[model samples]
Target: MAELQEFIDDRPDAREVRKALAVKLVYQGYKYEEIQTILDVSLGSITSWKQAYEEDGISGLRLNHKGKKSYLTAQQREEVLSWLQTKECWELGELEYKLAFEYDVTYESKRSYYDLFDAAGISWKKTTSLNPKADEDAVAAKKKEIETLLARHRQEIEEGKLRVLLLDECHLMWGDLSGYVWGKTDQEIAVRVVNIRDKQTYYGAVDYLEGSLLLKAYNAGNSENTIDYLRYLLDQSPQSKITSFFGDGASYHRSHLVQNFLGEVNQDLSQEEWKIHCVRFAPNCPSQNPIEDIWLQAKTWVRRFCALIPSFSHLKWMFEWFIRHTTFDFATLQMYGAFSEIKY
Candidate 1:
């Protein structure tokens, strides 16, 4: 409207002018059609301009509101956003501790003091694909199919009154980078790292639980290592009379070496003759295997206390430690409460 233009023109740097116009147009009794006729602007423009003035005050009265912050001070917004991006967080109340430790001053702060940090509009996130590399629905269906087959086997054995060992393998890569919460994001990202010292070295494990175990890593996953891992498990739990083994459709699990090893192990114990029945999971359905959850559980522990791990060996050691302690705690044994058990 001519009135709005006149107001902006007359009031040089008059921030309050925008609030006055908004109150009159929207809050006070004024017909938008009549107001538009008087101002010579469209309803959309009026809406846009009114919102603009409310946000920027007098500066918002401008035709556009760009490169300006709302509620958040520039430095405060930057600091808070940057902190959120890292693995560190400073409490609003204890911010005085940081002040005292660094600047030797204890400044008081209110809980709402962080409101400006939130109003900076930094928390919005863009949607990302659950499986950026593959179809999620297909993957889920495959996992379900594998689970169903295993469930059928378990049901049959249970009805017939039998105890069977579910033998399998897991590999530990020395340079496994695992996943991380890095890069420019409001969401977490998973990045793989190569093991420089060793590539194909693996670990095999066989477990007989109601569910399945899965070995996860980058492309460095293979079968020879899986069998070797199984051998180790056999050595430790020699008394375990497992009857069968199940694995996902990875090339390693189906390889000649793995089959030969299992055959040899079976032949050695001919008297017991535990059935070497094997079932392969639907291809690429790692989620169906409970072992994947095991790895995720391990990684979550690393994120809780430590930020950057120095090397792959450290990662392995810490992971083993976390797993041992986590398994011991009753709180952790309960589904989804595993991480809460870490007293340290």
Candidate 2:
């Protein structure tokens, strides 16, 4: 420990002297945060410096003191870039290992490796979720069918005789309250979870013409709840004679219980004149329903204020409040050619 101060005093290079000083601070029982403020270095760098000094003594604190030089020839750099482009994703350690083994090079700073990634046109990004079972042809055909239906009801919709609602269900868990936020690097941001698996079921519908949202919280998403939600939508739009629902192919949506309720509601009316009509999108293709995006927006809104939520009931209240109050103007609402070919 005493030798670290002597090394810091004797080192000619300012960079090496700084590394030695950080190591000496750690030996003197200084916290990483305090050392960071004192040295203006990151906690990660302080940790690495302490580990390096413990493993290799004073020699480890010296920057590029050994035979190693952080350099690669132009051709070698191009080769590394080519190797990076061969894969869709990578870990930083993989690049470090490749440079150490193949090119016999190592950079003193991680920024150099990041520069290589930039040169290779690679970036850190979040991955999107896609269902492998989705059929493109089926999705296209369903979209076309929906477009034709909307066109046929264009006059009725404009006259307030028919209300087209894109419907979907959301199962939000308490764990969803946890999301990314900027905080100190040395500390972790955590949301206290009483029951991580505690779930809330929500039925959301977006009015096609008005772009207004309707949301209802239910105990569960079963056939009974499905029928009740449909009734709820009807009660909300009493002005519209016909209420049409576009939703996913959930089992409860097509169950006999819901069908029986629909039968009772539209007993005398013809299929075209039915008071309540339900249309299912392509199986496993959630992207076909614009209400899915509305649900996402609602969840994102609640997650933004997750820290203030004290209980799951409060979370549910916030989630429902955001959905019911917000008017959606998302472009996805017009994906089925709404407001263009099929005018309001």
TM-score of 2: 0.77
Give the clashing residue pairs of candidate 2, or none: none
Off by over 4 Å in 2: 1-66, 241-246, 340-344
Q: For model 2, how does the per-residue alpha-carbon lDDT over 1-344 read when each residue is reduced to its tens digit?
A: 77988897787988898888888888889987798678766555666677778788888887754533468999999999999989998987688778866876766466788899999999989898788999999999988898988888778877778888888889989988987777899898887789989998888788887898888889898998988899998899877765555566689888999889989998998888788888888888888888888877877888898778999989888888887788889998888666622435
Top-scoring candidate (TM-score): 2
How high is the CA lDDT of each candidate model? 0.47, 0.81
- Per-residue error for 180 in candidate 1, Å, reads 8.9
Compared to the true structure, candidate 1 yields what TM-score? 0.43
